[model samples]
Structures are given as structure tokens and as C-alpha cells.
Target: MLAVLLVTSCTSSSASGEQGDDAKPRSTSSARPAPPRKPVALTIAPGDRAAGVEPGAPVTIAAVDGKVTQVLVVNEAGQPVAGVLSPDATTWQTTEPLGFGKTYTATATGRGTDGKDATVTSVFSTAAPRVKADLSMNPLDGQVVGVGQPLAFYFDAPVANKAAAQQAIQVHSEPAAEGAFYWYSDKEVHWRPKEYWAAGTRITINASIYGRDFGNGVYGNDSRTAVVTVGDAVVANADGATHQMTVTVNGAVVRTIPISMGKPGHETPVGTYVVMSEHTDYTMDSSTYGVPADAANGYRTTVAVASRMSNSGIFYHSAPWSVGDQGHRNVSHGCINMTTENARWLQSISNKGDVIVVQNSGGPVLESWDGLGDWQVPWDQWAAGGKK
Candidate 1:
């Protein structure tokens, strides 16, 4: 019997174990898809709750394998710190300095390649210096000075790292002059050109000392700028042999004055001098320099006009008492004595930084530490920085 065709035709089951042909196969592997890529680590300098951090230390936020998206840094006073973010948003840096002895807060946010966010925060305090060095500069800002003037700086606290101090003080001049810095002491420094400054030169000094380490726990207190203008090239060359002073202006001889310089025992120093100051109706007291007014060589003389040339008691003032010896021989004590009229005329034409050269005086050379004796040292020696 066809036996009802006994056709138990066996059709294969679907790969999905379903009866329909449209059924899809199922995955048998148990492995899940690889996890999303991890984000880059974010770092902030002066880590959280840091203390005694240098104000000038790089207050920065950086990331690797990620990008910085935003940043905020503020002082305790609610003042925001100035900062700049990298163009690629990978780093943030502080542009302005932080205040000392104050707590600061910083927040930075970043995003990783996995599309994840990273946030970081820091609370830090800047170091408080044991001592702050006060800075003083000359020539005064916007003042006019003569060509021989050197830009001088004085620090109240001694600087152990003098080279760093010297680097912080920069001098810029128009028609650039070859110059160098000479340190007279731990707290004093002066900058001068190899030759006298050219008339009409403009000079600017930048003292970026704030946050600088001067060593010995000393720190700079502030930053400053000074602008000075150089005026006429007024020079006075005094000859102890000729007993005359030839005054020149801009390389032209302007006047010839009969003068009596220091006596044999107290000869004027033979070197260059820069005019320091001018006085009107001032009294010259010998006791100021330890010479008693009652002493034989000491006298309290008052003058109408006087131009102080040296710190150790020297001036070309109205010494009418020595007018009789003018143009004749050395008679005064370590000063160029001149007539009152001539002295007044000299005062009228003089300004700070003017040059006064004493030649053939037979006295010892001027000490570099004396007054403004920056020109006393040869250029080669002066350019050697100093014994710092």
C-alpha cells in the first residue's frame, strides 16, 4: 500500500530552532563586545589641599589622552585668577601671579576619547616670604638726566642670588647702547653704557622682581618700570696742571673758567665723576662726614648754589674765600673752588649725570664705590658682571 504514501518527509529544523525559513541564527559565543575605551587621566599642579606653594610656580592643569574643556581658579577674596587655555584645550595656565599667603581654589573639567567627563579641584596656598625686598630705582621715572648717568637700583634686603637679581632688572634704550651691570654690594647695582650715553637717548628700566627668589628666604615685593630721557652732553674737564676747566656742550667748547682745585695734601681724585645732586641755599657742614666743625680743616660754609660731585665731601661751590687763588694754584681742600658768579653760571647749566673729569690731579684714582663712579672702571672690567 502506498501506505498513505508513508511520506514522513523529514525537513531540517531552522538554524534558530524555529520552524520558519526566515528565522535567523543565534550567536553561541559568550564573549560580550569590547568595553568602551578608557579616558585619559587629568592632573593639576599643587595637588588638592596643597600648602606653601610658590606664587610663581606654574599653576596649571593638564591632561593626557583627553582634552581640557573648562577651568576656573579664584582667590579667597572672590577674585578670579587670570589664566589661559591651550588652543587644543589640553592645558590651562595662569597668566597673572597669585597673592602670597592666600588660599586659592582651582577647578578643571576634561573630556576623554570615550566621550566621558573628568572633573578635578584643588585648594592651595602660596608661600609667605620671610622677608620682602624693597626696590628703589634712579633716574626717576620721566626725569631728564645727563649722559653720564647710570640706571641704579637699591634693595633693602641683601640679595644672595645677585645674578638672578641682576637678570630681573632689564635696561632698554633707544639707539641701543652697549651696557653692563656692576654690583657695588649685596644690595646695590648700577647699569651703565660702555661709553657715555648719547644725548637724546631714551631709556626704560623694567624691574620684574615680584615673586623672584633672592635667596636666604628673601623675596621681591613688587614690579616696577622707569622711563628716563638723556639730555645735552654737558661735560666739564678740569686740569690740575692748567688750573682751568673747559666746559663743553655737544662736543663744542662753551666756556673756560679759572678754577683752584684741591691742595697738595687733599688732591681731587683723578677720574670721571657724575653730577649727583644740586643744592640752592645749602649749608656745607663738615661734621656730616665725621669732621668736626671746630677742626682746623673743617668749616661750615654756606653757598648760594652748589653741585655735589662726590659723596665724600666734594663740590664746586661758591667758594669766594678761595677766589684769590683761582687760576693760580691748588689751594682748596679736595674741591674745585670758583667765583660765586662762575659757580652760579655752572649750576645753571648743570644737570644730574653730567660728566666731570679730573685729570693730572696727582691724587689716587676714584673708587668705584664712591658716589656715581660707574665710569671709573674700564669697559672690559666693568663688563665682567661682578664678584657675585
Candidate 2:
């Protein structure tokens, strides 16, 4: 009867959900809470630790899922590189440019949401080119050029990657002028507006080519800058049929001058020309254009005022010898000869880039690449970014 009573008591305790001997206790610590989250992870770029990175490109360290505390980049010589940190403290970047083909180390630290700390380190290197080409440009700083002047650049080496090299240059003009670049050769380029620059336009050109790749294992060695201002517009129109020349300054007819152009056999080139230079007292030599000094059409003389218009020895100079035929006929070799007074006036008001338009001259069109003859190319052809 006692055994029956014990079994019945055990069954009663099970039904009431009461703990019994040999039964596990219902403690509150049965399932432990999940462990705290891990700290933020660090990532560094230039994925491979090799010598193929651009020195100017940003070397960045970034953290994810948390916030970064600090970052440091140092060269092989233990020099600390200058860098800028983000406002959110999640990223850092090196500001000071790195040296080519040099080793560098980047170390970053971050903290997790649950107060845990983490750190990461990376090693990388920059590119080293076989040749570092430098750049030079025209329309130098502080010079006042004419409205038709083009900003020219001459690379020290031929650029195989012409597109990349062209893109590295930035040109900005005050009052905004639309322009494009044209390549005369592999190493020479020029930039010009669709039309002549307005009077008083200011232009600044910057070549940010340092550490940039220019193809064929060549890179840029340095940067360059040029600032130029456009002065007044001086345009001269000479007509072979009328035997007259009219000059304009900033859209107004400034003066009219009687002139004698090249004779029938040696008519002046019938196209646009730019005045390359001017001189007060200059020598005129027909031999310079391949004519013999003692030949029938060749003569050597001095002029009081001469303005050079072409590389092939074209000029407009004071010719007291031709003054009698100036307003009536064309009787010079291949130059536009005018009175001394008119030549001096033309020289005084003209800049290096001034324009001279010759009409009905019965000669071949002026060839581009002839003494600042950039205006000969059509805009569509120029905008094609030649040799790219």
C-alpha cells in the first residue's frame, strides 16, 4: 500500500509541472544570447601589390559595417604621406602624390558597433614608365595675342595614346569661348575657337599630365600652365581686282590704303593669312623663297616697315619703288607693296595673330600649316580629334 501511494504522488507532481529529483532545472540561462557583432572590415585599393598604379590616383582605405578611427600611409623610406580624411570618419585618402615605381604601406583602424577594435595593413606600388615626356605650349603667360591666335602645345615625345594625352589638358576662357583641339603632328597640337576670339577674351590652359600614361610605356613627367589674353581684332582685306586694301579694328573700318599686289605671273595666295611678325626696318630677300638673288624675279632690298605673312616668304612691306603703280596696277614679285606711310600704319596696329584676307588674287589657296593658318580647316574636321 505504501509503494502504491509513492507512484501516485509522482504522477500527481508530473501533472502539476513541478520539478522532481533527476529532472533538469528550468533555469533562465538555457540559451545564451548571440555573441556581439564583429568589428568593421578594412579595404585598400590597387588590389595587387605591384608597380602599375598611377602616382596621382587616390590611395584610399575604407571601412564597412562600422566607423574608421585612423589611417596612415608611409613610403619605403618611412616618410608619412599627406592624406585627407572623410567627414564621416569612414575613409581616408593620400593627397600628396607618390613617386613612380615606389613601395608604400597603408594601415587603417576601425571600431565595431559593440566597441570591438580591428586593424588592417596593405602594401602597394606605383607605375614607372620607361620615358617621362614633358610638355611645352605657346601663347605664353601674360602675352596679349590677336583674336585669331591658337593655343598651341608641343610634346617632348610622340604620344602614342593621343586621346589620353589630349584629355589631360584643360582649357578655360573667361566669357566662354567654344573651341576644339587639332593635331598637326604626333607631338604638336593646337586649340582654336569655332570663330575668332572676341576682343579681350582671357584664356587659361592647364596640362595636368604628371604621372599620366601616354601609351607605349611612356608617362608624363610634369605639369604646365599658360595664360593668354586676346587683344583687339585687326583684320585687313586686300582685293587684287580693285587694287585696294581696307583695314578694320573691332568691327569698324579704321583706314583705307592704296596697294600694289603680286604681278600676273606671281599673284599672291588667294586665302586667309595671319601676320606672324612685324619689324620696323627689315630686309626683303627673294632668295629666301627659292628664287636666285640675281634672277629676273629676285631682288634684295630693305624696307622701312614689313609684316611677315607666311613661312614661304610672303610679306606686305613698304615699297617706295612701287608707289607710282600702287593704286592702279599690280607689278610686284609676290608681295603686297604699299606706300611707306600705309605699311607703318599696318605694323603699328597689328598683333601676331591678326588676319589678312586676300580676294581674287589668282593664286592657290593658302595651305594649312603655313604660318598660323589654322583657320583653313573646317570645324567638323577639326573636331574629329585627329590621330586619336
lDDT per model, in order? 0.87, 0.84
Estimate TM-scores for all models.
0.80, 0.79
lDDT of 1 by residue, 300-352 (tens): 88888789898988888888887888988999878888888988898888789
Residue ranges of candidate 2 with Cα displaced over 4 Å: 1-45, 56-71, 83-96, 108-122, 292-296
Query: What's the TM for model 2?
Result: 0.79
For candidate 1, report its TM-score. 0.80
Flag clash pairs in model 2.
Answer: none
Report each candidate's C-alpha RMSD, comma-separated, in the order given: 13.1, 11.5
Can you write out model 2's per-residue Cα lDDT over 214-308, one digit (the tens) per residue? 88878888888888888899999999888999999999999989999888889888888888888887989888989988898788899999998
CA lDDT, candidate 1, residue 94: 92
lDDT against true structure, model 1: 0.87
